[model samples]
Target: MTDSSNRRRLRVGGLPQVLLQWGFGGLAALVLFLMMLLTFVDVIGRYLLNAPVTGSFEIIELMVAALVFCALPLVTAREEHVTVDLFSHLLSARTEQTRAVVVGLLNAIILTAMAV
Candidate 1:
């Protein structure tokens, strides 16, 4: 294949992928850390200072939802979901590939249905 054709098949280079991955991953991590920190502060404030952080529960609830939903698309893109593979280990490579494709198709259909 020509160099140009090879280049066409290639995606963003290593540096870009690293940057993008870390950028999103860091955002997710920061949200989680902030959530924990706020909860801790609120607890301490209520018990020790006799003044709770106002709307702490509401903030936590919203943060939790945002964290999960925001992470969902990234996790799907990263292919990071759990799998139960009682039979998969026994399958040949081609069989495994076919199984994966089928699973992906089903997931796509389910996502589409959910969207509707």
Candidate 2:
């Protein structure tokens, strides 16, 4: 296949995929925005009004967790994880792809086990 065709094929499609991608993106963005807004309000309340936003620290901690979880799927879908491709020059394209898939599956299984 041509490069364009390969690129097109690799692009995410379908309602479910699109929805999942957007859902994750939206969730992460919302969490981050809320965190920033909360921090601003907390700081203003503390410094200007002599009253801090109650539970802001706990809320921020929860938001951080939520942000990480929300971004996980998007990161995985984009294959944005760090890698050490020491054998990039030695491995064929197919071999590299197979290796990636196998590694991803193993990681998924481990994560699922941990979640369970």
Candidate 3:
């Protein structure tokens, strides 16, 4: 690829980028690990002690939300998320740009609504 093309690529280079990736990825990993541990303890409590962890479901739910949020930064930085390119093959270059903007706006709106 040309220099311009390389420049246009994701700006995920250098030490800061590495730190950003590690920070978010580590946070997500920690959350996942904690969730697993919680499940293990909950199971032990249920069988061995005949008592389950109180509010385990609520804790898991909150952890899941945290897991998703923590993963978002890493996903956006790496652009590793899945894409719907099925429609891209059918559109022209100019139309593709417009479609991308419209879809991005729609996505932002939907995500905002969901966040609220």
lDDT of each: 0.76, 0.83, 0.81
* Model 3 deviation from the true structure expressed as Cα RMSD, one decimal place: 4.2
- Scanning candidate 1 in windows of ten residues, the lowest lDDT window is 5-14
Index of the highest-TM-score prediction: 2
Q: Which residue pairs show collisions in model 1? A: none
Instruction: List runs of model 2 lying over 4 Å from the truth.
Output: 1-12, 92-95
TM-score of each: 0.67, 0.77, 0.74
Candidate 1 lDDT by residue in tens digits, 1-116? 35674344335345675566567678778889989999999999999999999999999998887776556655665555798889988999999999989978887787667556
Question: Candidate 1 vs. truth: CA RMSD?
Answer: 6.6
- TM-score, predicted candidate 2 vs. hidden true structure: 0.77
Model 1, position 61, has a per-residue lDDT of: 95
- Residue clash pairs of candidate 2: none
RMSD of each: 6.6, 3.5, 4.2
Supply the TM-score for candidate 3.
0.74
Runs with alpha carbons beyond 4 Å of true place in candidate 1: 1-15, 106-116
Off by over 4 Å in 3: 1-14, 110-116
Of the two candidates 1 and 2, the one with more favorable TM-score, higher being better, is 2
Tens-place lDDT per residue, model 3, 1-116, is 35564345535386777777778889999999999999999999999999999999999999999998888757655545588687789899999999878866776687677678
Which numbered prediction scores highest in lDDT against the true structure? 2
lDDT of 3 at 36: 100
